[model samples]
Target: MTATTRSNEPGKRSSSGRMIARVVWMSIKLLIIPVLCVAALIVGLAIGYVVLGDKPLSDVFDFNTWKHMYDLVFAEGG
Candidate 1:
């Protein structure tokens, strides 16, 4: 009696290959949260402009917005 081994089959992955794939997948997952937060901030800023109903669309990306945010967060109360 002889045993025959088959190398080609479904659901088969080498240990190193699987580890590399897992690392790549995890890295992508970790990056998604920060990316989504930034996207949400941009969306919120745009929405704020619409809600205010006065600012121009370009203001959302302007430096003044960042400066104002910084001041608002770190300003000393008189």
Candidate 2:
């Protein structure tokens, strides 16, 4: 009946170790989800650019289109 009494049980020590390991594993999965989502979004955008070719992006960003959109959104009146 002493403090060293518990240390003598190998099964208890192994079970505690397993519990700690499971907590660490669950924390890692929780942190990985958001990082994985951002990575997927960046990769998806890159693939979209390549698949869409170059012309469409150029048209989307064209000066007249930008001016028209800007004017529509920010103009003093509709």
Candidate 3:
């Protein structure tokens, strides 16, 4: 019988599953940045409305608030 040699290098991953898992984790990390940005935007709007705008916290998230702002910015009186 002939002897065969199997190379087992140190720190080299032999399983394709580990590579796929690493790729999936990287993708998840990349997607988190945009989600965090949207969250920060919502928090900023809420804080601005409550502090600078002096509006109630409950009204900060109301649809009418944004609708009014949109209308004012696009007013036709110019």
Candidate 4:
């Protein structure tokens, strides 16, 4: 084969390789979004529980309880 034909073969292979790389990157981003969201939520809930400390069982379900919990965990010195 001529030098041009040999070089063209590598170019075609690289094009396909680029396409595969793009697909894999997109797939990883798709998977990462939900994973990150879940991680954030779990962390938030854990911190919320710690800050809510010593509340009654009934109060645990209240909105204010969660608000206070969020504030305490996220607030300064919490």
Task: Judging by TM-score against the true structure, name the best candidate.
Answer: 3
Q: Which residues of candidate 4, in runs, are more than 4 Å off?
A: 1-5, 8-13, 54-78
The runs of at least 3 residues in candidate 3 whose Cα sits more than 4 Å from the true structure, single-residue gaps closed, are 1-16
- Steric collisions counted per model: 0, 0, 0, 0
**Which is the leading candidate under lDDT?**
3
The candidates, ranked best first by lDDT, are: 3, 1, 4, 2
> For model 1, what is the error of residue 12's alpha carbon versus the real structure, in angstroms, after optimal superposition?
1.4
Model 1 TM-score, 2 decimals: 0.65
| Tens digits of lDDT, candidate 4, 1-78 | 666554665445676789999999999989998999988986666566556655445564578977886898899873
Q: What is the lDDT of residue 18 in candidate 3?
A: 88
Candidate 3 — what's its lDDT? 0.90
Please report how far candidate 4 places residue 61 from its true position, in Å: 18
In model 2, how many backbone clashes occur? 0
Candidate 1, position 57, lDDT: 86
Ranking by TM-score: 3, 1, 4, 2
- RMSD to native, candidate 4: 8.5
**Residue-wise C-alpha lDDT for candidate 1, range 1-78, written one tens digit per residue:** 999986776789778989999999999999999999999998988988867757788877889887998999999998
Overlapping backbone residue pairs in candidate 1 total 0
**Model 2 bad stretches (over 4 Å):** 1-16, 55-78
Of 2 and 3, which scores higher on TM-score? 3
Clashes of 3: 0
Alpha-carbon lDDT of model 1 = 0.88
> Candidate 2 clashing pairs?
none
